[model samples]
Target: MSVPKPIEFRGSALDDLRAFPLAARREAGHQIDRVQHGQEPDDWKPMATVGQGVKEIRIRDAAGAFRVIYVAKFADAVYVLHCFKKKTEKTSKADLDLAAKRYRDLVKELAQ
Candidate 1:
């Protein structure tokens, strides 16, 4: 197999991920590792609202539901745009907007 691509956390994603409960954080890491290796996460869904090719990794644990929004279409690395604990069934507009902003920032940064 080819070498795995590294993950680049955008905005406050890393810090946000660190805030997840231990179990949830570990699961998130495992799922992201799968994405790095060009494999699908255990659970995921397209996040077209964030951008083209963007997706969200879903992780549920005894504590709560968590999400990691990312884009892996680029060759160099998988970009993690957002990480958050989901308090309700629906993803909040603020969370969606934050991820989209981060995605746009990443694209702009890479273009420079």
Candidate 2:
């Protein structure tokens, strides 16, 4: 079996996570660790392609629903593109745009 890639969070994604309540943040961290270790949590779902490969980790707790967008296509790492509290049934265009932009930036950075 292949080894799992390390997970790296973008500055903006980290900032978003920092704003989460303690419980949600802790759960998200655990889920991310699972992904890093090659286990795809049952709650995770693939996002429609915008540019680079992206998937969403869905977390719902007493604090409410939270979403984490990440790309795992890189050879050496999984890049967390965005994290935010999901306030509606549908994801906002602004959030999608931000995550897509971050994914694109990470792809360019990896190529260099």
Candidate 3:
């Protein structure tokens, strides 16, 4: 079997994911693991506005809702662009902007 791709957290994504409640954190980890193994997360949607190949993984727990924005199209690794708690039905502009910035930065860095 092929090895799973490594995960590379961009910006403060890892720390933000860690800030999730225990259950939510674990669930996020599991969903990310699916991405690493070349499978889709249990709950996710395309984040085309963020960038090509970007996707958002959704997690809901007793604490509230959470999200993990990542891009796994590159062969080397899965790039997690951002992580945060969802505060409303609509995703905050701050979150989208951050993820887009990270995605752009990742692309620029990889091109070097």
The CA lDDT of each predicted structure is: 0.96, 0.85, 0.96
Error of 1 at 53 (Å): 0.5
**Candidate 3 runs further than 4 Å off:** none
> Taking the tens digit of each residue's C-alpha lDDT, what string does model 1 give over 73-100?
9989999999999989999999999999
Candidate order, TM-score descending:
3, 1, 2
Q: Residue 87 of candidate 3: its Cα lDDT?
A: 95
Model 2 segments more than 4 A misplaced: 1-4
Report the alpha-carbon TM-score of model 2 versus the true structure.
Answer: 0.89
TM-score of each: 0.97, 0.89, 0.98
True-vs-predicted CA distance for residue 13, candidate 3, Å: 0.4
Look at candidate 1 and tell me the lDDT of residue 109.
86
